[model samples]
Target chain A: MSNGASGAEAHSRTTAVALSDVNITFRLADSGSYTAVEGASLEVADGEFVAIVGPTGCGKSTLLNVTAGLFPPSQGRVDIFGANLAGLNRQSGYLFQSEALFPWKTALENVAIGLETAGTPQSEARARAQDWLTRVGLGHFGPRYPHMLSGGQRKRVGLAQVLIRDPKILLMDEPFGPLDAQTRQIMGNLLLDLWSADRKAVMFVTHDLEEAIALSDRVVIMSAGPAARIIGDWRVPLTRPRDTAEVKLDPEFHRLHRDIWQTLKAEVMKGYEQTGGG
Target chain B: MTRGRLLSLQFLIAVITLLAWHLATTVPIGGVTLLPPFFFSNPVDVAARIFKWFAEGTIWKHLWVTLIEAMLAFVIGSVAGVLIGFWFAQQPRVAAVFDPYVKAINALPRVVLAPIFTLWFGLGIWSKVALGVTLVFFIVFFNVYQGVKEVSPTVLANARMLGMNDRQLMRHVYWPSALSWMFSSLHTSVGFAVVGAVVGEYLGSAAGLGYIIQQAEGVFDVAGVFAGMFVLAAFVIAIDWLVTLTENRLLVWRPVAAETRTQA
Candidate 1:
């Protein structure tokens, strides 16, 4: 709405991805079904950076998977750029939580595969992939296999692999879940740098609230699951081009953090309790 | 550890074994022969027979015949394995339906089929190829199947997310994965391919190393049998070496245990 002045149909037009009253219930092996998310509705405006944050197993990833069309929501609609999503969201790039790289391919080949599959010539795709790899600070590591690289290095390649295709929307599910704290911050900043330069509709799901606040324009929260639903939404007031680590020092950042924590605390405690933890 | 030193050491070991064989066959112990020459020919006699065959060029025809049969079996069997393996992997229903039959066939000792193959294809190279195909097919089929099954789900999902069509997914995701497993099982399949050919020729064939060995054994020529076995051993070793070189070239991407550790 802020970007679009056109009346009536502007909401749907401006929206890059919309999930309306989605209910994802997975059928268990034993004839029973478990509802992971229920009545979840959210809209990501074109080029908007929205992060979905929640406690562990609160269906944070389920929402992203729904957006990705990895599986359909049991009961709702998913629209990509106002068009109904069918088999897959062709306009969106997905960064899986675990290692998704083809182990047999070199870093360059993995990054270029998206382009190659889309009918780009090998030479052109290879050139563009090289440029993207350099953007991710891995120009010389092109020949290395995924197993030869460290976790952080592999994450960089994954980023390049997804980004080289220039997807209109980015669907990330805990992209930094496996990294150490320092590497996580580094990756977060790198993500912001790339996203800021080429704005894309990003739905980043993470359990780390701090990460959600640092990288996203708006932070949305979900309660603990067996029917998890979005409980709160807050627009981050921090200015643009902010460093992920340095943003934490601001007073406004602390105030926003405190407010969200109070609401998140109960849900997090409930989440932990559900998992048989304290 | 150097290449030259390793080769010499291996040659020295071979010499010692031959020396032991010669002493056992030729030398008398307390005026009694430990290993009779008629049963176990001396190494020198076996060596001379091998030299004589090669020098006369009489072995080339049989070697060529056996190589042709083995090569045909390997090509046909591997291609069939790969095609069927991909089909079964992509179609779960088909795989499930054929599971019992597949298990039963694979469990049966395939050597028994040599006679049947000879009957169907005749006492020619085709029979030998058919026998070899039976041996090589299952080894490659299982490897391909395992390869496709073990492909990382995340990698497959990522490929799908890249907007790759079914054909592209097979080329990008499945083929390379399955190829790796197939290549890893190469030596076994190759050995089986040769074994199949030799066994078939032994059962009913006019040509091939197996035929010559059969002829020698029928005549009670122990030295000829020993010579034939040594040649077969050398031939197998040469093929295995080629396989190793091919594996190194193709699987260069595989992480070598010590040399290519995960880099930070």
Candidate 2:
């Protein structure tokens, strides 16, 4: 691709992530293979905030993992900033939905490890890790192990762990899925505050419709799986510096939510039906 | 339930049991001894024998020998176990190839290996240490394998995302995880190490706690046999206490479910 040539190509060159016609299939333990996502294509522009909201088990996380180069899509291509993706997308930082913090390490050490592994000296990495901890409102919690922290506090540390590395693309898979409603709202605000300071292309995955609309610049929806596809893409018209709680009261926010939900409701029911019996 | 009350209750049980034993051995009931002193050796004589051994400092050398053998075995076996365990865990193909062989070896009673070890290493401390190694190895090896497996996939994925290479992952993630698992079985493995040493020494050795018991048994000294057994029990408890301390130090990050209850 030679980093492309023309002005239009140059503009496309600024694309932070472009996954074109990606298909992901997983081989089972038996002599079988299951297709999760088929012909899935989406692009995240530089500094754009995008949320992929879908029903549970709709292979939404699989799509994010594909973007991260966690595994190659079985039948399609992944392109990062005009370069063909190969192994781990080095320019990205991923925040998993599960408990990923090393239980044996303190919060500070977990945050510092990224830099340390990249050859930064211990003193400098720890100092910067402390700064990141402070930014995430966990300045004094550096010494506490992951088990000792509350769920909300641990999420804060997780956020710090990713943000400390300052990756070009931040891939989050339901980063607030485990927290309570109140705590999720608080974390949503904290995430927006950090993203605003140093904007990156973020691909956030969640099932919470209200959350998807509240925090994102655009909302991407997916249909139910066994070859799930991106079904809808809607731009949120609400302005930034928007509080997650206050934005819900906006009539425009309601309109956008109503429109996205209309296309999403059928898929949500299908997902539930698939999971209902089992 | 309270600490002081529990301690007093435990002390009371011991005193009651000793009193019963003392009365049973010395006093005849219905013109026949309840527990003949020749067989049971009365609690008083057993206690006095233990006291005399300590007071004369004659038991220290043998105790030291057994402790040395057990400690060496523990160190060697645990190290080898951890290394091999890591090897088997990370390399699935190797693990798969060796799977049946590992199971077969583990299935074999470790005690049965003692005679062969003595034949190979002779009747010196190395043989006892070798025997102890066999006993300690499997407990740690299986635990370490489990620890590596028990490492949350999320944690490993996050570490990879954080840019840890294979060696770094081994150090920060795998080692700590395996070590925690090893510590969980600390009491069992340490007790096995002592058992291995004692068994090796008992079979045929010049000196050790086991040898002392063998020597006294050869002379038909019942009190001495009882005294040797008591000393071994006490020795094991002391080593177990030290294991507990080491476990506490190494696994401070491990969540203790009863920690809050115990503190309160």
Candidate 3:
């Protein structure tokens, strides 16, 4: 088991998040149990972008939730930075897949929500929100409501909401799942550029192999449920501040992609077999 | 401009109808009054009577009394309904337990409550206001309760994940979700508010348009009764218009229908 000091030093050197033997289960009304994730252990090094890829419903989101401290695991522990996550209020930043921007608030206000929640003065939060919005290339759209913005723009606002906090760890749950392929690629590159600058450890959850490979320093492939676990973890040797388009042309990228695909293919098939497929 | 045109169309229809009634009463086909003498009581006579009432009774006095009663009921009922509805919505167990009781109360003939209210509060404006409040409360309560209950789980989860405390969640998510429903019910409640006030006045009251109408009916004055009804209808329409204006201002985010857009 990775101890506290090792995790801290690792973060100082580029480790952002650490989880040990984390397990999550849901109890049923019929007195039965379903283990969503079982004994999943992993470390996200500081400045290291990691992706957790799995077949649908493999508890990738459950793992993310545990990491965020939104849900306590039925077993094991999760530590962010060098600190135990027992009573920490705002250790990590999260970007939900749906963008979940408040419909009543403008894009700027939505971005400022995190700072406001953390007790930052309204003016300071608004200013920081504006700065982050500009960074996301949405400066002009600050006043537009969520309903008025397109899917891509809403995701940008969601990203800005988290980025404004500048937490030690970033957890994103399929942030670009709803966007078109082109927009998804654009967002992927943008995320890489943003992360490359500060290099906060990011645990990005996605089903897309291409997305995982493009943005992550390490790809953690999770197995299928009734008990989804991290079956393989591969360190991608792709250079930092990488261009997604350029990375695709590298033969090494293709090799890693093929390996990850081969490992995930069986899990995907098993998932299909378990739940009658598409 | 469209509003002006619509008003003009209504005036044109009123004039034509009045003219037809006048001609039918005067023509006297086959020595029989084709239209009853009371039915064709010339628009001129009704207009003169309205003018007399306007001058003698002072339209503002009666208008003020009715307006005060309706407004009082509207405020009392709406506030109580929202408070009770929100409280009930927050506790699912309690809401479920009391749901049938609320429905039964709502289903009971609210008009029947007017006489009981009159008995309790007397023939004063308070009785009318109380009756009006009873009628309005249930409509607003049910809508607000349903609205709060129907808050999206996805939105609630998102708010929770964003670290919103319970009060903040209620303000940001639940309140806004239920606001539109509450406003829609308000539009309907306004008429009921007026109806309750009028009914209470009719059952027993010394003042108000309802009392005037009741008095007219006692004297076999059909024209006066119709005149009183016309005044009440105008009052109801005016209140409805105000409610609509408030709704439009509050619900600015709601998309305008294609027809309204084209009309604009």
Candidate 4:
């Protein structure tokens, strides 16, 4: 653990993303308002992996969007590396819940899009894209377009596109949420492997408890909402290079899971009530 | 060899049609000339008249004139259509504001504009070219507009996240997405180009196949009309082939319906 900490600190300055009393609201067409997220405050440490778990409409996605500088908070402030993110488009990588590959470009070209837009030479960008594709085990598939690829293959290409840039902070909104269980497990492990090598500050949004436990150093659980708020924050004590399967068998893992689930269960019931599910 | 087979098929159909016509005309089953010599003339006579036209330099000269008019109109119309369509697609509010006006113009009987174009541009090839451009432009424009509109939102978001500026997005994303639609429109527009050119010529022209056909009609020479039509059909087929070849080359990334199944 000390070695892992020292390594992360040595490679890059820990860039903290702090959200102070952030409130976000949306206006409905018919003279009413909806509060997606209200008074949500959280901080993600640099070189840390934080997972957000919540019921549907709890504004987990909205929180990530604010963090990415995609949407402005109606109230409060978001700071990245101690710099305010007010009307400023931060250079952060975002992986949507969907694979989101551009159907027109070949996998290699899609991956190189970031570098090309940043003014890198086409040939150099392509070579670097190829290198990243190989890292994600899609070297031979680079020439094929996204529509030609299977869902799993497309997801890997999407990851490669984001990974190649090595952005200061990564915000993923249910990146593996759509994959089949087996594929999801494989992708989860792949993400951990990638992160182990270069531990960038990552904010992952998911509803899956096991996924949250497997990937995050900390888990932030949100209450159900007309106005959602963070209900629990658990610091995961698992060591680095952790085997997802092995971690599940650990006694501490079960204890943490139980603790988090107990907090979430009431919120889940309240979510059902709000949606008229009762 | 394929050309040989095509010609043979055409010959066989021609022979069958000629036999039916000859029997109908000579048999005199009714008092009416059901297969009139002045209107539905004998196929053999039409073949001989076509040979005479070929000898008189009538075939090559008029065919060349019509072909040039059609090609020029198609090029001008398609280029203008693509540019305007892309521009309109980028500005949704402007597109919405003018959409009904554009549709109103499209719905207006374009054939009626033949005389107006002739009056505006004189009775030269320019009038025919103008008419042809109007006919082809709307077809291509509508297709390209719809194509650009239907670009996947997910893909656009992904491109934005990847740091693609508006120019790069337009070049890589919008163009490729709209290309197949543009090609489909081009195929249909080829036929429209010929219609516009021939109709404009028929309305007011001293030259072109349409002029020859009109003269033949005035003289009760049915075979000449058939020969002119045969030449027009050949031109349409040739242009269609060119469009197909270009489509195949430019759209190599697009998998054919059959290829998609195989990949699956």
Residues B1-264 of candidate 4: C-alpha lDDT, one tens digit per residue: 587898999999978987898776655666776776766877678778888988887688888888888988888988989988998998999899999999899999998898899999998899999999998999888888888998877677777777777898888789877777888667789888888888888888988878888878878778888888887788889889887777666655566632533543
lDDT of candidate 1 over A1-278, digit per residue (tens): 11212112223448999899999999999999999999999998887888899999999998998899888889999999789999888899999999999988999999999999998999999999999999999999999889889999999999999999999999999999999999999999999999988788899999888888888778899999989999998878777787999999988778888989898999999999999987
lDDT of 4 at B61: 83
lDDT scores in order: 0.90, 0.89, 0.82, 0.84
Q: Give the per-residue lDDT digits (tens) of candidate 2, residues B34-109.
A: 9988878888788899999899998999999999999999999899999899889988899999999989988998
Give the Cα error of residue A68 in candidate 4, in Å. Answer: 2.1
Identify the runs in model 3 with alpha carbons over 4 angstroms from their true place: A1-15, A29-32, A82-84, A87-89, B1-52, B55-57, B256-264
User: DockQ scores for all the models shown?
Assistant: 0.66, 0.78, 0.35, 0.44
Candidate ordering by DockQ (highest first): 2, 1, 4, 3
- Please state the error at residue B33 of candidate 3 in Å: 5.7
Interface RMSD of 3: 2.7
For residues B1-264, write the lDDT of model 3, one tens digit per residue. 589899999999988998887777666888887877675566666677788888787666767778889999989999999999898998889888998998888788877877888889988899999988988898888888888888766566666656678788888788987777888677789988899888888888988888878988888787787778888998999999888777766665444422233454
Question: By DockQ thresholds, what CAPRI class is model 1?
Answer: medium
Best by lDDT: 1
Give one digit per residue, the lDDT tens place, for model 2 in A215-274. Answer: 987789999887999999877767778799999999988888888999899999998898
Per-candidate clashes come to 0, 0, 6, 0
Best by DockQ: 2
As a TM-score, model 3 comes out at: 0.87
Better of 2 and 3 by lDDT: 2
Interface RMSD of each: 0.9, 0.7, 2.7, 2.1
